[model samples]
Target: MTSDSMLREVHVRDAIGLVLAHDLTQILPGTFKGRLFKKGHIIREQDMERLLDIGKEHIYILSLEDGYIHEDEAAIRMAEALRGENLSLTETHEGKVSLISDIHGLVKVNREFVDAANAIEQVVVSTLLNNSVVQSKGAVVGTRVIPLVVKEQTVCQIEQLALQLKQQAEREAGPITVKPFLPMKVGLITTGSEVYNGRITDKFGPIVMDKITAFGSTVIEQRLAPDDRDQIVAEIQYFAELGVDMILLTGGMSVDPDDRTPGAIKQAGADIVSYGTPMLPGSMLLMAYLPVGDRRVPVLGLPGCVMHDPYTSFDVLLPRICAGETIERSDITAMGYGGLYRC
Candidate 1:
């Protein structure tokens, strides 16, 4: 049949045994709204009454030519082009396929690839923001083509583009991937004379521990230290000696004379990435890497706000750190744009 005659709209009574060209949706005000007949479904005799009740007097039937592709097939091909490691694809439904995470990790997307894909006519690939944290089975991306029957060449262009991009990057994976978090052994040090001297109960350790555990890591040991710079430095060295993957020092990060966490981190032979950030509630945060025997361990000097704030710079960087990323000054500086949390 010619392209113009590829799709035929027939009355519901005559549609029996014919395949549906696309999904048919039914809506009952505030009661229900969903697909009544999926794409490619062979219309049945029993479906006539229900189809008529949903006001489906006529429905289109697809007789695709060699050069044309159905939406379901197009969606599957598009998802294959976009699927990366640690991601799973859902069955195509209503011309769309969703990308789901197979593990709890950070979702990374190539924004340039997404932009280029969307630039192709009738093609759609939508994704969550790059570097988003997702749990197992969370949906991260959706892929589909706009039309019920797209020209096969259109879909091929997307596949070729993905191939070219991957080849150029010298990687085997596609534009989207989930990097799993590493279970790091952490050492925590609470630095404040008020808590170290037993004048007040320590709260920072518990909060820090909770955050670490949530990311599938544990605090190997928790140490208390007075505000003295040497004492704080000594605790940092001790954790380095223990070969902890990460060290977290909470409190005393401010510029106050008695607050010396930042200086102590530097004194302990760490390469400070950033001693401060532009993010509120975490402006005094410190990020560093301390050299061990063969590897460098991440050391963070968290500001006082971390003990109380629901989300701070610590929360921003911890996941990346746990994912085996080296925190950089650029990363710390970039947090400023979306960093304002308090009113």
Candidate 2:
């Protein structure tokens, strides 16, 4: 809380030791960073030159509106409403609270809940795509109050909306959460006569290997099979017998005459989750599950988009799979809303 009697405007040079009345942003070449100085930050003599360089001839040393919530306090309340497990909050700056991932995993944001919260006046919660794979210490979301000073009631309303969302979600972790990946042993089968022969080197194997390793998984068995349905099926069966949790079949997912990976999975008695996706460059993707006795093995058929597209349908679903999510047709269809991945 700030009182009107404490308001003061002071020159930059004379502002040393005075607390900043608001947040100050510091931007460098090719980057715009925030929180250079928070509202409650006490000015230091060393910051004087930097402040002058940023074109601050004078600054408001202490000026807070009456009957309104300060930006920092408002941001704190807003962040508290959305914080979940594996998420940590950074210091508030310019009325913004950056949400960072505490571990490398998949991020889940409840869209309906977020929309309802944002509908409240003076409240904003911006986040990355839902189910995005975020690295440890990466920035995932940001929460803030739009105005420098908002009516106290605005904060209360935003908090109430968040509470409602949490209740509706019925999860102890709330509407926003990160599902950590489980350790997995993945088997990869690359199918393409061109690569199986000596014609062209296989490119998809290394890419898939890197992705698996980054998610704390290992490629226990990798095999190259010609574009023959029986050979692909045989390879998948072999891996499943080896007790691999997941199998990836790449390079024969497209509609070309040589593309037999989908047929091979069907021949292997795998239950097809979805034959294709609505995502651009990845619409030919396939997902399936093979039941081996009491165990179920997830099988993914990757299209050529995996080799080129920076982010595709495979990227969208891999994290969920790694997090032990059983992705259904409806889940894949929901991704179509933001599935267009442009190079």
Candidate 3:
């Protein structure tokens, strides 16, 4: 296709390959183009039809990062090429700032910073990096910044910054509000003969339960799949059919000969979100999301520590998932310091 005037468009299709801005003409006129287009740019419908003539081919656009090959889509479908933690940021006229608090040292510094700023609006804060007390007003808002730090609350702070910007925009634009998506509903699937047959007291179930609940969700369904792969897969599928937004499979996450959760998950037609988070005690964890009709239900394969430990890698992530926050590999990668690194 050829045109006299220059235009730019992003094309998205399912086929996975690498292409360039210039090569897209095979799909559409070179005039349809992008400015400052980079990897992971999302493409919309008009661009799709105009580019690949999507109806005629099996190609489906995944992301913008794939040269002109894949573009970003809002369906919450992340492409394999998308990397790092987006962490979700929003912008006002004020510059981007991270809130670090609850620790005595930075809280004072943060308070001073907020108080001094003339046009500041939102703050991203993580409290208690140290065992110090903050003497300032516990909560600050408006020209004030709320002391948003809580134990392992770094993700919460990041989320608040994103929301604060959105809220401020709504307030200024006119009254508009909508509920953020509810945390993904997760069903806990613990696989072990001991737990399933009642040989042991089912100690691990409680731990998984507590952790799930802490992340702003209730374990609406819980079950034991035993050591059988078929049973485990079936239970997971049953939960999927039940409409649980996520499924958590505890125990039997290891490479032991008896471990069947991983194999069962693969057989279940579920795509892996991630397996083996780098954090300890939960290293064997597995995360996958599968579609039930149109919505995705994430299933988690949590290892042992989700019970005994106060926090693990899952603790850092589950809330983001439960909050309907997308877990890009980068989000998990940022926890390298165990949420100790601020923002």
Candidate 4:
């Protein structure tokens, strides 16, 4: 369907000098299914045979009027207004502009700002959910004006509102940013006497390694320390001295009397970031940072949830950390809204 505007009918032979009102779709089973000629394309002699081959005897084109903005121009201008750091834009075409991620990283979107912009007349920008982990070159947002033609005044209002939203978001964070992942040299420590003594197979170790490896990092060194606070502290110290980027204290983080991993992190002289989270299946998560020379190494105390649960708070936070994000207590607290992992 065409955008909100009057259309002018033109015969295929008389289509030159007119703008296509809608996309001309071409469908061929198992081979092609896309636009033969995009909307807003100006007709030319070369397009006549192609248009006829696509079964177009006549076509509808936008009847341009003064004081009205064309869809292509509107989309480009709107994209400029909505563009933020770590975002790239493709050339506007067919009245659409795609916002792409410039790096493999976490996507941070200011939803409030996006909503405000969408509320403007004829302005439409769709994006991935906030805090989504995205790959580089992936399309994060698709923007276009709703109508084929809109009043120039409407366009001006959209740009102004977008500017206000951008400014307000800049005061806080921004409308969007791709936080790139860092190459982490992880020191893995498996806690629990059962796992360490080989009575129970070390399921957490392989799981932690898999998670770390997915983010382009590998376990530099791994230690199985029975839930002795002193022994855990010693393992942590050894990894620190080896200059690992982060430490993973897996298993034995529950309220059981045998769980001593949390205290051991404290004894190892790491600043605790948070001892718990609101997320289910992983609420017992613990996070800390230890100083090794001039650098601070993050030490994560994963709950028992990582052993069996396919997803949990650890999944949400680990990628951000790998992306060089310094997660805080408030970050964990704010996760309660979507913290139900079981569903």
Candidate 5:
């Protein structure tokens, strides 16, 4: 159980040296080959004269010149061995909760409590990273040892809390059923003469489709419409009749004279909630709700950037929308991470 005992059990060869170098290309892909202490671990990039290494680009050199193994460095090596099995914490998961009042029914409440806790913890973490502080009374869910009055917390601390909670829960109870969330049906409206007329390929449709898939939702209907306002308006009404849950209008969202997507959306009798987002590359994103009888069909007009970049204000906001998120203008205006646009 001791650190020293565990390291010895790993039997990482005690190659006493200023630097212990290991060619990872020669080692297994994801095997945590024990704790490597003695520094001076050098990496000979790719033994290029040999077979081409897939995906390996850079080399890591672990040096012991500083002397003594930092507890963190030693621990990271061991953690590598427990890769996929690690279920770090989350603030929201698609787990169901049955109240204690229904305890007589066939359900376990404790497991759901743990899941809910994890979700809260993750949200707390997300807030912390953005420099926002949570009050003691506002501790995140599933946070072990909550009542956390800590002033500053790192990502690792958040991850550790999640891991510990998972281990403790697994010991105390049997696994509750983890249900897959019901996928919402989505409809895509691609608007642009260039794309629709083959002046340029329609890359925007696939990008939106991928987002739908990532959310575990289905793009039940997809249509390519030119910058013609009438076509856009007619199709929106047509899909409304088709009983679609959500509609996405891409391109032709800008303020250009040719941008008819927004006008057509309005003509569909859909109430525009927000005409544009404040985020760059996604400034033209629009959100609206079309009242279809008893239900409100959520509609989003994505910016042109969503086609080329994978992550944008749209990407972050879309999931929250799918989760039935309530949004204020302030929420949409806060996404200013110029460098956070990841694909």
Candidate 6:
């Protein structure tokens, strides 16, 4: 709490040449709502009527003693302490600073560090969910303090916590980092006899191509294979021989007798990570890794829902894979939470 002796209150008419101690917000129903006077703004003789119209009959001027810090300064310090690679900070505004991404990539948030920092009195740090996808210049985190001014020790405690976490992680970067996506060469195989026999036009090609290109990767080659496991396995090996970074097998992911994509993937010498995910609209998704000449290429058996659904397990895992993250069984199992999607 701020002591009364630290603030001098005077009528707006008599406050000319004095600095504003805090931001003054003006609300006009639905028309306008924002800071009409920012902290540190010098009072002008011409501004008296406007301030009065906003119901500001008096204003406070702060006289800070030692060991105290203004909210804007505190927020700036917090942002500096939490900023990591591929992130930029916005200028402090209304005692808040935003962390922006410098590239399109995966957002990795250190929840433990964030929680520890927020435990300090008057300190606030809000971030996007862990493993979220972010585009360039998108705001991922915001930092601020609750009061107009706070004890310098509060800010110091937050900084110290951040430093300790970074040291324990053996990295100089802060809690939030954006890992840039790598440009990969992907091979796509569309299974099912109907599409291979030309009984129906192939629909998975365009959709899969769009998803691949969106992540800065290209489908170098695409092949259509029937329900024969041997032919599907041959195509997988061919792509691996080409040294593509990833192989995508679409269609035939279910457990029906004719759906041979899962067995075909395993037959191609792939180490299956997870045969199915717990996520809705994509529960039959399969994840695997194919070793080729000291490199482990990612293999994904995408379900049919990926064709029309706006988001699915494929959406959740694709970004992480493009960011060079290895998908594990635990990662697939964790998708059960917040994975249900309805049309």
Clashes of each: 0, 0, 33, 0, 17, 0
Which prediction has the highest lDDT against the true structure?
A: 6
lDDT of 6 by residue, 1-343 (tens): 5835678998888889887898899999989999998986789999988898899998898767799887888998999899999999998888899999999989999999898888888789999999999999999999999987789999999889889988999999998999999999999999999999999998888998998899999999999999999999999999999989999999999889999999999999999999988989888899999989899999999999999888999999999999999999999999999989953
For each candidate in turn, the TM-score is: 0.91, 0.80, 0.50, 0.87, 0.50, 0.91
Please give the CA lDDT of all the candidate structures.
0.90, 0.84, 0.50, 0.84, 0.53, 0.92
lDDT of residue 149 for candidate 2: 66
Q: 1-343, model 4: which lDDT tens digit per residue?
A: 3334568778999988888887899988899999888877899999999988889989998877777878888877776666777888898777799889888788877787788778876788899988788888998888887777877776687677766775765653246667777889999998888888989888778888999988888899789999799999999999998989989998778888988999999999999989998889789999888988888898899988888999898999889889888888889889898799774
Better of 4 and 5 by lDDT: 4
Q: List the residue pairs that clash in candidate 4.
A: none
Off by over 4 Å in 1: 1-5, 11-17, 25-34, 44-58
lDDT of 6: 0.92
| Ranked candidates (lDDT, high to low) | 6, 1, 2, 4, 5, 3
Candidate numbers sorted by TM-score from highest down: 6, 1, 4, 2, 5, 3
lDDT digits (tens) for residues 15-77 of candidate 1: 888889878899999999999889989999999999999999988888888899888889899
Better of 1 and 6 by lDDT: 6
What digit string (tens of lDDT, one per residue) describes model 5 on residues 1-343? 2223222111122222222232233444496443322222432223332213333333233332222342333223212211121112222211111111111111112333344434643222111122121222331222122221111233344345446655886652222211122368888888888888988888778778887786668999888898899999988887888898789888888889999988888888888778877666677788888999998888888888888865666866676665555456676666665534433
Summing lDDT over every window of 10 consecutive residues in candidate 4, give the lowest-scoring window.
166-175
Between candidates 3 and 6, the one scoring higher on TM-score is 6
Give the Å error, residue 222, model 2. 0.9
- Model 1 TM-score, 2 decimals: 0.91
